[model samples]
Target: MTEYKFSDRAYTKMIFHAAKYPHLAINGVLLAEKGAKSNSVVIVDAIPLFHQCLYVTPMVEIALMQVDAYAERENLVIAGYYAACENFYDNTLDKVPAAKIADKIQENFKGACFAIIDNKLVTLEQEEVALKVFSCNDGGRWSKSNYSLQNSKSTLEAVSVLLKRGAMKDVVDFDNHLDNPKHDWTNELLNKDLKQIMAMY
Candidate 1:
């Protein structure tokens, strides 16, 4: 049974997306590369879907196609699907769109998994937490698995900005009337002040 390893940058990306829209359910694809030491997957980046209606919308399909093309060029594979729900302890992950999404990804990438953001870590305690990974078993049932994080300077910088911005303090779906631009987080990642803020931590 192959396990998943999440790079800090990729983990932060998933948390940032969940915090960005805490009230609604957010889903995304995890890009990963084969590990060198053993049979494992190293999650590299996430492509988030802020807007989702029903199951697997046409827009989501198009986005996945584009992501797959990009991943191929980068020598990465669509290794998994991740979801953050309205409630922190939402147990519908394996029963939600994520199940179908993970199944679809596994069709091409056999060891694909699903990660559900542990909402409590974001809502209650402002501390480190491990996101859970579920890999499909022989019967296509999701089995709980383990994953470790890889620390990096970029990830530290990203965390600094999230805290300084008081992102977790905001109310989820507060800006319901507004639409989130896909590059919002990317622009923040390039913010000049981010370096200054990261230096403090």
Candidate 2:
């Protein structure tokens, strides 16, 4: 059993992508570094895939290659995959698409995890931070576990810049675009965060 630490920036990106496409389930890769002394992983960042289907398509495979190359340059490993279910109450990550994606991730990185964003808490007001992480064992069985979050000023800066540039909307690629009316909730949430960040300056 390894402990996982989710940096503020990494969590922000995960939540942002989830919020950005509340109607569609979005998936992405988690980048992390091995900790000293103990068997632990510190998630540094997330690379989201706004365009994904029920199956991992050729495009998704190609995108993964790019993510791998990027990770190499950054000196980080592909730790796992994170996804948000379209329905807020659906916390099941062992289903078709998630299970299939996690298998691919495990094939690449041994002890890879699959995290599901807690959309119910995220979309509505809640006390707990919105994320649930699951790891695949040697027997290829998935198990739920707890993770940590460490806030970083650098992450806040990065998220703020992306918001200022409207990067969320622009970064969506390949499949369906995020033109759904439900995006209003996401947009408002992001705007509120951006404003709070601006107020600090």
Candidate 3:
């Protein structure tokens, strides 16, 4: 059983991406480095891919290529995929959009995990991480998997503050970048701000 540890940057960005477009389905890739322990993956950041046309391929391919190149330069791997369903009640694996992308990620990285944003938990008052992780089995079935959040308590608190401050608007996705090349989907500024805010909690 491989363990997935999500850094505050990764977790908060995923939540922010979904929150930025509450009525649409959102998807992204997770970047990670091998953890100190065997069978552990530490997800350091998340690259938001799309909030529109979740089933499209051309855009997805282009985004993946760019993200792959960026990950390589950063010494990270695309370790996982994440999605936030448009329907508030659809948090199950079957409801995960563009699941083929996740399968492709697993094909490349056997330890790849899929994370679904739990809409009900995506609130300022929510105390727990709003993600449900799933690992694919040999039979190609996705089952719930356990994951840990780096600085769980503070991460939640920081996210709450960020939401209240309407910081989610600062999050950019591939769609935004496509509309305006200058919109940096890397979210470097947001990551830095999150780190500083999280430290205070």
Candidate 4:
């Protein structure tokens, strides 16, 4: 429910975000009609307060279908699928590097609502942001966390330049969670560079 104005900043973010998607498609995991029509998903046109974005509120629609299994319930209930992926063909499909357009979304133009990534339905927010950033950034490809979000048009790249100077320690990695994942880049050049810049914080 955060409403944003239709300004250059907002348009810039929309362009970066929408460049990955061409159009919306189905989730591709519907049960056989005779098997159990219990769990269902729906796509609704969202008249958003910010940028007039479209959102696919899956849980609300699935609940209307009436399923009894908690696992199945949790398995597919999401609110942003239609706006994120094209078909959600597979779970391992990470295509952050493939989005082709970056045209900024107009303030109240009613943008599409979805929740897929690399072309698969997803529920992880940070991962989604990471994927979007991964799509927007060109020239070099690497994954980092808010360190990059700090570089969004809203932040005006000020944070990125600062981090490039010398920053803080214990910076949040893109994969940071209850327990840090070992595969994540740490003690790397970007981390060292950012840590140094964070000294100003």
**Which of the numbered candidates is closest to the native, going by highest lDDT?**
3
Listed in order, each prediction's TM-score against the native is: 0.75, 0.72, 0.96, 0.19
Q: On residues 30-104, what C-alpha lDDT tens digit does candidate 3 reach at each position?
A: 988744342688889999999986778899999999999999888888999999989999988887757899999
State the displacement of the C-alpha of residue 180, model 1, in Å, after optimal TM-score superposition: 8.8
Ranking by lDDT: 3, 2, 1, 4
Stretches of candidate 3 exceeding 4 Å from the true structure: 34-38
Estimate, for each residue in 40-96, the C-alpha lDDT of model 4 and write its tens digit.
212211111111122233532332233213214444321222123444543232532
Query: Using TM-score as the measure, which candidate wins?
Result: 3
Quality of model 4 by C-alpha lDDT? 0.25
Q: Model-by-model lDDT, in order?
A: 0.65, 0.65, 0.88, 0.25
Write candidate 1's Cα lDDT for 18-52 as tens digits: 77776778777888874423348788777665434
Instruction: Compare candidates 2 and 3 on lDDT and give the better one.
Output: 3
Better of 3 and 4 by TM-score: 3
TM-score of model number 1: 0.75
lDDT score for residue 171 of model 2: 33
